[model samples]
Target: MTEAAACGIDGVDTGLADPPLLVADGVTRWYGHRLGCRDVSFRLWPGEVLGIVGESGSGKTTLLDCLSGRLTPSDGTVTYRTAGGETVDIFSRPEAERRLLQRTEWGIVRQNPRDGLRMGVSAGANIGERLMAAGGRHYGRIRALAGEWLERVEIDHDRLDDRPTTFSGGMQQRLQIARNLVTHPRLVFMDEPTGSLDVSVQARLLDLLRGLVARFGLAAVIVTHDLAVARLLAHRLMVMQQGAVVESGLTDQVLDDPQHPYTQLLVSSVLQA
Candidate 1:
């Protein structure tokens, strides 16, 4: 397909069309002389999950940072179309613009629970703060919403006032997910949402995430080193090696019949390990 066709950028909104929620064009990020990743590009459809998988240092996190406008791309643009039908290049926007998007339209769940969550705050406060930041400040509404999100992630509401320090690693992660989801963003970016939990915890959280993504109609980019995580969560998969996408396809096709040697190695590693 042509670039314009792939971008869905040629007057295609048509009022009845579903516009792409996000676009990254030739997006690249680097540290000094070394390229973190370059010539990277992708688009996200609303209500879909696109998984990014690669070995460590393959730039999965870096690419996500760039695409989510968390890290400024050394080259190229990260464009986003708001639900209001206004399009803006996130990187090109001022800090205030980015903040507006972060507070309202975009949510990111980081790999480290500590990094993703407010470790100093109570569980209810953590999720409630996000709703407040998104312009919801009613104490009753915030508390009720926090309870709803806690329940959504299967957290016991009785412990809502307890600090994250009091929770297990998996519960903390669930709090982070709740914090992000309460805002009802059109897109969410998750970096290893299940990375730190044990097998049992991971299984439960993965199941929650699968159901949550569908329930919320959230478009998502999930970054992970675990192929199984990608397999369980992604409808589409993008494989990276040495900071470049080596392959992308439907998750089942790429995982079941890897065409790239690097992808084959990834699949083999999962199988052999």
Candidate 2:
């Protein structure tokens, strides 16, 4: 198939006709002489999850950062179709405007719980912060919503007042997820959301994430090195090698019948491991 057909640029059948919620066009980022990611482009529609998979240093995380607006790409644009139906260039928007967008319409789940959660604050406060950002003003309502979110994440309501630092790694990660999703952000950017956990913990977290994502009908861009996690959560997959997308397709297709040599090796290695 041609590149255009593979990337869905020529309106390849994606099973859904809805317009894309996000578009990354020719996005490239460089760190001095080294390439972080190069000429990456894709469209993500509402209620879909796109997984980026690659080995360490393959630039999947860097591409995610650029897509999430945490890093500025040296070239190209990241356009988002907002909840208000405005297609805006995220990078070109003012920093304050971008920050507001992140706080209100976008959610980011960092690989490290410490990066995503407020370690010093109570779990309820962490969740409440997001609600407040979404213009929620009633103190009682905010706390109530936070408690509800805690339960939704499978945490005990009694632990709502506990600081994140006091929670276990898995619990803290769950709390971070609760904080990010309390406001029901339309788009979520996740970087190795289950990467730092034990095998059992990773399974639980991934299951919870899958459920919450489906329940909320969220559009997500997830970066993960674990093929298992990608298969569990991603509807579509993109494989990167040395800062470039080498293959992409439905998750099952990419894993079962990878077309690219690098992608074949990746799948084989994962299965063998």
Highest-TM-score candidate: 2
Alpha carbon lDDT of each predicted model? 0.89, 0.92
TM-score attained by model 1: 0.93
Clashing residue pairs in candidate 1 (N, C-alpha, C atoms within 3 angstroms): none
lDDT of 2 at 165: 88
Which 10-residue span in candidate 1 carries the lowest summed lDDT?
1-10
Residue pairs with colliding backbones in model 2 are none
Q: What ranges in model 1 sit over 4 Å off?
A: 1-17
Task: Evaluate model 2: give its TM-score.
Answer: 0.95
- 1-273, model 1: which lDDT tens digit per residue? 223454456765534246678888888888998889878887777888999999999999999988887899889888899978998999778999898898789899998889988888899999988889889968998999899889989999998999999999999999999999999988999999999899899999999999989888899999999988999999999999989998998899999999999999889877543
lDDT leader: 2
Listed per model in order, the count of residue pairs whose N, CA or C atoms clash below 3 Å is 0, 0
